[model samples]
Target: MKVSAKLFIVGSNSSSSTRNAVDMACSVLGVAQLDSVIIASPPIEDGVNLSLEHLQPYWEELENLVQSKKIVAIGTSDLDKTQLEQLYQWAQVKPNSNQVNLASCCVMPPDLTAFAKQFDIQLLTHNDPKELLSEASFQEALQESIPDIQAHEWVPLWLLRYSVIVKSRGIIKSKGYILQAKRRGS
Candidate 1:
């Protein structure tokens, strides 16, 4: 299956980490060979905080990336309603299969999910850097928690997204596995 995966790397402080996350997300979405990534630096250029002015450059790239009919996974921190709206506008161009991979600390603005729903975009949230771990306890915890969770809740997406981040960060301490996306019309 040819799954289109889009990864937005927000607050990527280093080139190496950013590259690894992109590579891992691509693998998870079953499109590693395709390399469809969108790197969104935090709105703040020199710090962790968000500054709208700083995101202009990223906006251009984001607009271009979402033009495809592939699934997009955004790896970002918290965003307000306005920022989320901007993202929705960009992703709406193609619609259908889109995933927003965000940090655990970054709660989905009330309207982000609603906005995405309009286009059938799946808003996926992930763990912050501190939560990326491959320990047995972590796996066990996830196994126990996922079933009871609702899609609107953040845990499900957080775990899945974190796994990709862990692999990309080279912190998994094991060989990585690729996630294949189901192909279109399959």
Candidate 2:
């Protein structure tokens, strides 16, 4: 049976990222407790890499929400077999699912498929990449719509997945985009 409500939130991470999540949810949709959270940190960033060490804290926070009955499930995004395996072995709550970006390599990686089967973790797909929007690219798009806004100074902060359970309003139901900004050229 459906428990209270299931709120799915997917986003990139940083030191105070989880706090950003709660604030965004509360501000936009009044969501107090999130259900399923999909971690969307790109598997590779510059020289940074995905390791059990990097992912543990995020999963642990999700796990805390699950244990506290604030959330029901937790998931990952774009992680491959080796990475998924390491996370599965180490995570206290164990990821309920792993999302594969269809654009990353088209067909799901064979090894990832095999691993998901063995573990019973659902393998899902998404079109959005970790860099869903880039600084320059978003600015370019915005320039066409609103010329006065300084595209150069604006930077995308985070993206979240939230569903408005209330059907009464029946319009512009759900989504998340909270941007953090910093000036360039100090």
Candidate 3:
């Protein structure tokens, strides 16, 4: 099967630097054509940070955009079950599995991990090693110990919201045909 590359940017802050990083990465990685970009509101803070409640206001607009377009990237630091459920309900899409993608530096709580598994989501971890290993035996052992990976079955709707925000802000470009096709499919 052909796998369309869909990038999910979780825990993204709304700072200029954060936005720029995502934009730059999307451009360099050529992620604009693959799927949607989702941006969750930053968490609330004492005049210091963006909070989830702060993001709630934009939820409707974000949802509209996702429904209109078909991208699937989202930015949010809050990944708790309650929030996840709310997002799923808002997007009107049921998550097939609780699987989540783990990129380098993204830390997840053990309880959350267990919760995700209970929901039937597999945790996929990807690490980019920059250094060459000197021990071939150790490398072989590591390779033998790693298990095979599989894709999750469900796509969350809140992810759709995040994807729309990313597209609206021009962090990523939307694919016209794919968006149209997705809308029709829905």
Top candidate (TM-score): 2
Q: Compared with the true structure, what per-residue lDDT tens digits does model 3 show for residues 76-142?
A: 3334666655555555433333333354337776776766667554444434232112233333544
Q: Estimated TM-score per prediction?
A: 0.38, 0.70, 0.34
In order, how many clashes per candidate?
4, 0, 24
78: Cα error in model 3, Å:
3.7
lDDT of 3 at 158: 16
Better of 1 and 2 by TM-score: 2
TM-score of 1: 0.38
Using lDDT as the yardstick, the better of models 1 and 3 is 1
Error (Å) of candidate 1 at residue 122 is 1.3
> Tell me, what's the RMSD of every candidate?
14.3, 5.0, 16.7
> How accurate locally is residue 116 in candidate 3, as Cα lDDT from 0 to 100?
63
Could you tell me the lDDT of residue 184 within candidate 2? Answer: 50
Q: Tell me the deviation in Å of residue 142 in model 1.
A: 32
Please give, for residues 1-186, the per-residue lDDT of candidate 2 as tens digits. 111221222223353555455455555555556656676653346677777777676667667767875566778877889989999998888887888877787788888988899889999887874566666776787777789887777655554555544345545445545554444542
Q: Between candidates 1 and 3, which one is better according to TM-score?
A: 1
